[model samples]
Target: MAKQYTKNLIKREFLKLLEEENFNNITIAMLAERCEISRNTFYYHYEDIYMLVREILRDELEKVDEEFNETFSWEESLLHAVSFLLKNKKAAQNLFRSIDKKEIDSYLYKICESVMSRYVDNECQSKTIDAKEYDKRLVTDFYRAALVGLLDKWIQDGMKESPDKVIFRIGKLFDGNIERSLRISENLDEA
Candidate 1:
């Protein structure tokens, strides 16, 4: 429990620093001073700042995965995921603008792929679409690409619009198209 608390302290301090300066400008000594812990303590909890970021992103993505799976429909799942990101907009934006954009992208892709794959598998089980594994993966990749592109643009724009507006627009564009796309893929497989 004490270790958890210490790690959380380090993360909080790191995020505060992230918002103020570029990630590359921040260092272990700075984070340690902010946390009021020794540099050794910081290293004991995390190998480095990048590793800290990976853990932070992984934890948030896990929440996204869990919430998405718990929801009834893919649309709801997508909304849940987006809401999660918006709720953590500062952290999200900081990571987006951070030097570790690649790491953030990797985590976002993993979360999207996980959610889309589960959505496809559940839809197939419900007979919403009949698709082979390869087709399901292809459809998942398509949705993941669209989602990541949308999110990247949204973040880059500083999340100017409300979450509801973005969600509604995305739903209008994709709410029904996913199943249709999957079905098309299934037909192609059959042919």
Candidate 2:
């Protein structure tokens, strides 16, 4: 309870500073000052700034996972996930441009892979596809790569496009073709 509150406060301050300066430029003292907490309190909650960033990324992924679980459609799930980025554009941008970008990319890959896996599982359950686990994983990897690629571009381009517009374009590209594409790949592999 209190611990969670402290962590959240620290995360909030960290993100606030990320907007004004690069993650590398942010220090424990800066965070403590912004949050009005002692430097020891900041260290009490997080081992270091990297730990805070990782926790925030993991927390955001868990949030989207929960939302995805409640969703009836993949589109809804994806939009829910993207809403986090939309809401935290400044923080997101700073993280992307930070020296810790590799960490951010790894986290983003995990979230994308999870989302793709969920989408594949839901589709399989609906009898939309009868794919083997391997095929499903292959498809998941493909979509995850594409999704992450698009996200990298979006972040690099300053996220100028709206999430809805980007999502709609993605849906148009693959909304109903995942199963068909997997089948096509299987057929090509058998040849």
Candidate 3:
């Protein structure tokens, strides 16, 4: 219990620092100082700042994953994910400008993939579209990449636009698109 408490303390302090400083500028010593723990204690919980960042991201991803269910519309699921980035805008921007940007990209991609996969499956079943397994995968991957790319561009642009507007636009584009894609795939499979 104490061990978990210490680790959470380190994580909390690290996030606070991340919001105020560039990722490259933060050091283990600084994190340790902020956490009021010894350098060895920081090392005891994480190998380095990068590992700490990764663990934080993984935890957030798990939370998002657990909260998502079949009942959530794709837009809602995406908004839920984007809300995290918007809430942590400073830390996200700091990380995006750092060498660890790939981690953020990976996190977004996984979330997009998960959301798209479930949406596509549900849509196919509801529409009674008999898409092949491979086609379903292709559809999921296509939408996942598109969603990730959109979010990447939004982040790169400093996330100035409201998430709701961005999600609404994507929702407009997505309206009937999934069903259309499945129909095309189904026809291709039959041909």
Q: What is the TM-score of each candidate against the true structure?
A: 0.83, 0.88, 0.90
Query: Which 10 consecutive residues of model 2 have the lowest summed lDDT?
Result: 182-191
lDDT of 1 by residue, 48-107 (tens): 887898788777778887666634666567767666566667766766786456765776
**Candidate 2: Cα lDDT at 34:** 89
lDDT of each: 0.76, 0.78, 0.84
Model 3, 54-86: lDDT tens per residue? Answer: 888888888777887778788888888666788
Q: lDDT winner between 1 and 3, please give it.
A: 3
Q: Give stretches of model 2 more than 4 Å off.
A: 69-72, 182-191
Query: Candidate 1 — what's its lDDT?
Result: 0.76
**What's the lDDT of the predicted structure labeled candidate 2?**
0.78
After superposing candidate 1 on the true structure, give the runs of residues whose Cα lies further than 4 Å from its correct spot. Answer: 184-191
Which pairs clash (backbone N, Cα, C closer than 3 Å) in model 2? none
- Ranking by TM-score, best first? 3, 2, 1
TM-score of 2: 0.88
Number of the predicted model whose lDDT against the real structure is largest:
3
Instruction: Summarize candidate 2's per-residue lDDT along 1-191 as a digit string, tens digits.
Output: 98899888888878778878877788899889889899999888888988888888889888878777734555567667777788879888887787466876787687788788998887776755556777888888888888888777888899888766776777877667886765565445432
* CA shift of 59, model 1, Å: 1.3
